[model samples]
Target: MSEKEAETPGKRTRPGPRKVTPKYLENAALFYLQRFATSAANLRRVLMRKVERSARFHGTDPAEGAQWVDALIARFVASQLLDDALYAESRAQSLRRRGASGRTIALSLRQKGVEGEIIDTAMAAADEAEEKPELAAAARLARKRRLGPWRAAEGRREARERDLAALARAGFSYDVALAVIDAEGPADLEGEGSL
Candidate 1:
């Protein structure tokens, strides 16, 4: 039998013996944040999960680990290393740039544990900078997917209905979708109101 298969249930797969110290947890948090953008709650969840896993392996009290996780998160927040507002703003801008609609951006930030007020502020900022975020996002999507005006003239006629439905499903309003689909060029999309 392979070594893994021969191992007893008590000797299962794990990341070796790890001492779950406060410093270790802090290092873990820093490493995670460095590699990925995450909200405060999400970071807490990740650290807590690590604590639970370590407790299970080492037969230690999870309560102590929980306290360490809380302390570390508090410190990170106080030091300005973990700002939910900044994270939300960055995430919203990324979503908008990727052609996501306003509704989609809000829902995504909510899923990431951002508050509604923060989401509204970020989206408002994006709106002010772009002058009609949803409309611009719709146009970007059309251009990227080669839908609407981006589609060849002969194919545009055939793809009109499908393109409209695609935009609707992507959280765009019918009016914006129709306008983008009927736009003759990029300037047309820019001049049209989002409504």
Candidate 2:
């Protein structure tokens, strides 16, 4: 390309590169943790993604960048700043309160890099405490979305299929979805069922 074409009249150039030193990575890690709770692997993935972007724009070696990422992750883990088990437990509780089914909570935690065993343990704890974890979550979802028992009587009949589909997409089992959809009122869905 000619110099004239390269120097476009109104195009914006990419920003200058930031150095990816250990101190820089540490500061980045601190900032990330302050803003969000994360699993060890999730934190590593976030830091490595930044490193990859930095390497790509600055023309640095990827292997070196990866090493830096690993070192920072190890430091964080050693300091107890990155704990997957804690993250999974906290995340599971939050999801449950927000009307997420056990299946949905597990999937969400797994996607965030939590181990399956940790997810299972956290959910098991929830189940032990709640009469029916899935039922409770489905009830909360119905109330929040104004589906089933929470819906206006005039609209309930028409919205049945759509409400069931919504529950299904949210990871509720067939029986759970049906229970939520068929509830006469929010109180009706408070207990466990044969399904």
TM-score of each model, paired residue for residue: 0.85, 0.89
Error of 2 at 35 (Å): 0.1
For candidate 2, the 10 contiguous residues with the lowest summed lDDT are 186-195
lDDT string for model 1 (1-195, tens) is: 567768765665545547688988999999999999988888999888888878888877899999999898899999988998999899888888878899899999898888999999988876776767788899988888989988988888899999999999899999989989988866688553332
Q: After superposition, how far is residue 74 of candidate 2 from its true place, in Å?
A: 1.2
RMSD of each: 3.8, 3.2
Worst 10 residues of 1 by lDDT: 186-195
Candidate with the greatest TM-score versus the true structure = 2
* Regions of model 1 farther than 4 Å from truth: 1-19, 192-195
Candidate no. 1 TM-score: 0.85
Candidate 2 lDDT over residue span 41-115, tens digit each: 888888888788878878877788789889888888889999888888888888888899888998899889888
Candidate 2 stretches greater than 4 Å from native: 1-14, 191-195
Clashing pairs in 1: none
Q: What's the number of clashes in each of the models?
A: 0, 0
